[model samples]
Target: MQDNYQALKEAGAEVYSVSVDTHFVHKAWHDNSERISKLEYTMISDSNKELARELDILDESGKALRATFVLDPENVIQTVEINADGIGRKADVNINKIKAGKYIASHPGEACPAKWEEEGDDVLTPGLDLVGKL
Candidate 1:
């Protein structure tokens, strides 16, 4: 998560992380890790699990499920991913989608697809020509 966070920071995006853990534990994790010290974003305290439950990203054990949400600059949710309990969350994927959303929204006449890249097509034009390609 920290590694992918650095990538997002490099891409001119602000990254915020939330955890179901207690504030003390979160602080301990931050204190124990040198990499986390360099992070510029907020690591939110969701000990009550309000955010996870609200997002429907909470597990039966009351822990935050591995999930991601991409929000446009205006804070509209653009894309979301909720992973299975056994699967790990790939922060890179979320960062990429956030980047894509930023790029598409700014450029207009554009949309992204599964695992999109920078050179990928800007989709959803008035004509259906780019639909299949995207």
Candidate 2:
């Protein structure tokens, strides 16, 4: 996702990463890892687990589960994705979802179908006349 930070920004989304680690630990890891060092987004320290508890993503082991949230301008959560430990996330998938969300937000009543790409013609605007057509 670090590599696509600019693309996310261009799509009018700000990316932030929240972790249970302290700021010092985060800084150390950022400094040591080449990939982490390349990230230009905000890194939040949640050592107290306030965010994790608030989001209800804390596991039984007292660790935060991997999660992603997409929020609108008013801070309303538009989407939420949570994964178990050791599972990885795909940035491209999140990017496409964000794009679809934005498109739907602007063009109300329209929906994007599977594999819909930005600026593509695969969007569907449902109506009673097309109830059984799709």
**C-alpha TM-score for every candidate:** 0.75, 0.89
lDDT of 2 by residue, 1-134 (tens): 78888889988889999999999989998989998898899999999999999999999899999999999888999889899989998876778878898899889999988779886667888888778786
User: Candidate 1 on 1-134: residue-level lDDT in tens?
Assistant: 67776788776667777888887987887899887776667888899888889898887877788777777767788888787869877677766776777777776776666656674554444457756664
Q: Which sections of candidate 1 miss by over 4 Å?
A: 33-40, 119-134
Question: Model 2, residue 12: what's the lDDT?
Answer: 84
lDDT of each: 0.75, 0.89
Best by lDDT: 2
Best candidate per TM-score, number?
2
Give per-residue lDDT, candidate 2, residue 88: 91
Error of 2 at 66 (Å): 0.8
Worst ten-residue run, lDDT, model 2? 113-122
Model 2 spans with C-alpha error above 4 angstroms: 126-134
